[model samples]
Target: MSKTILITGASRGIGAATARLAGARGWAVGVNYAGNAEAAAATVKAVEAAGGKAIAIKGDVAEEADVIAMFDATEAAFGKLDGVVVNAGILDVAAQLADMPVERLRKVFDVNILGAALTAREAARRLSTGRGGNGGSVVVVSSAAARLGGADERIDYALSKGAMDTMAIGMSKELGPEGIRVNSIRPGLIVTDIHASGGQPERANTLGGGTPLRRAGTAEEVGEAIVWLLDDASSYVTGALLDVTGGR
Candidate 1:
């Protein structure tokens, strides 16, 4: 049977890449987007083109109702979810902590931290063997910033990802015995539109220039790592943080 996976923020960037790759691997994909219906549709098309089943789901992860609806829609389309990719996140323009407004911090945490936690909660309820569900996997999209600390650049974003890292560790221990595996991927500067959204279109190249690899990573590269974590190939691995940072 084809496995089913719900990928949040799958309209573009790393999420889209993961959806495409997962589809190619014969998994049914639920491409969840925040607002870009066109991009989400395109992702669904790509999945179909890859000889896999898919559906485009619209929802705001920050809203609990929307998150619940997204999961409901996914299950309706695919019957069951074998995996989920907590990839939805955002960062505003770079700013120092002292210069940032409290609203900005709240928005960042709401989407990145609260959003992920709610999504994971739903995943646990549906995927936990102890909860009368089949075993499943969850792969969270964290950031290198969580370790490096965004500092003057994006402390809020970094802190949000740091929360995800800790959640992955704790959830892994809590869910592993229940046959649900949890892991995280900390991507370095990957060339994705998320940079442009953050008001730095060239940030990837700029940051990658300083890395040991001397080049920016691609969305496809990170996608490969994500799929591995969701697959049985990494069955023994849980609570592990895989970095797709080209050794940065």
Candidate 2:
């Protein structure tokens, strides 16, 4: 059977790109979106046009009920889930910790950290259903800010992504015994809406110039990396943080 993949927050940007590429490669895709049902449908149509099967699923990754529904729906759509891209992350309001609101901090944790955790947990839960079986792979989305610490501008965003990186490493260790591989993708200076939302539109230009590659990365670039990480071609790789930061 062809492998099946699910991607969260797949309405646009990196998640959408991953969905497109994975579908193009003949993997059935579960294109998930939180707020935009229309965009999700469009993504599903695009995936279908690429000669792969797909379904649009709506769910807020931070909400447990929503996440559960998403997983159930995804499994129903694609049969066994061979992989999942936990790309449903959020950026915090740009400001220093001293000036940041506690509510904003909570929202960041709720979406980025908790949402990634929820997706990871769901994949782990399903993987656990069949002990010692050939389980799935997961690629959690993180940010280069986790290592560089984009504080004074995006402290909360960094914190959330840092947690994902740490969690992926630990989860990989635990899930490896069950044949489930876990990894994270840390993107740097990707020209995505995430930077603009973080109050750092210039982040792309600044980091791009400073990066060894000297160019802002595209969503397609990161998406291609994510697909490779989940493919059989990447067997023997686990508990890794693949950097798609243009060598930054």
Candidate 3:
């Protein structure tokens, strides 16, 4: 049977690209969107057109109830799950740390940090409970800002991503005992809605110059790396932080 993989924030950006790439690899993908029913449906249609099965589900990864429901729906549709891509996250208001709003900092941590943790936990539980106690991999989408500090409206974003990177490191060791692999992809400046969300398009231009590759990457490029990590091609790789950044 083909593997079933769940991806959060599938409505746009890297999430959408992952949906397309994974579906093309013959995985039955569960496209999880926070809202945007139309965009979710379109993603499903695109997958179907590529000769893969997929279902669009609306759920917030930060909420346990929503995560449970999304997982249940995925199991019902595919009868099995092989992996998950923790892609849903947000950047809070951009500002210097000293001037950053407390609410904004907390909000980013809630969704970007806690959200990935919640989703990965459920995936670990369900995968462990399945046949032979074998487990699936969880690929978290982090940001390059985690390592490269930025002063322009990125304190909260960078901190949250840093938390996720450490979480993946711990999870990889903790879950390995159960046959599960945990990893994270720290993406460089990708021309995605994340720029608008973070309120910093100028950051993209600056990072592009600083990177070894000297250009902003595309969501498709990041998606390809993400899928490769989940695929059997990377079977021996686990607990790795793959930087898809253009080298920033």
Give each model's clash number: 0, 0, 1
- lDDT (10s digit) by residue, model 1, range 1-248: 47999999999999999999998988999999999999999999999998888999999999999999999999998887899999999999999999999999999999999999999999998899988777889999999999999998999999999999999999999999999999999999999999999999999998898888999999999999999999989899999999999888
Off by over 4 Å in 1: none
Q: After superposition, how far is residue 5 of candidate 2 from its true place, in Å?
A: 0.8
Candidates in order have lDDT scores of 0.94, 0.87, 0.85
lDDT of 2 by residue, 103-180 (tens): 998898998988989889988887653653349789999988899897678888888999999999999999887878
Candidate 2: worst-modelled 10 consecutive residues by lDDT: 125-134
lDDT at position 66, candidate 3: 95
Please tell me which model should have the higher lDDT, number 1 or number 3: 1
Candidate rank order under TM-score: 1, 2, 3
- Worst 10-residue stretch by lDDT in candidate 3? 126-135
Where is model 3 more than 4 Å wrong at Cα? 129-134, 201-206
User: Per-residue CA lDDT of candidate 3, range 175-222, in tens?
Assistant: 887777889999988888778776776666666777788788889999
Candidate 3's displacement at residue 110, Å, is 1.0
Question: Residue 229 lDDT in model 1?
Answer: 91
Candidate 2 residue runs with Cα over 4 Å from true position? 129-134
Enumerate residue pairs that collide in model 2. none
lDDT of 2 at 236: 86
Better of 1 and 2 by lDDT: 1
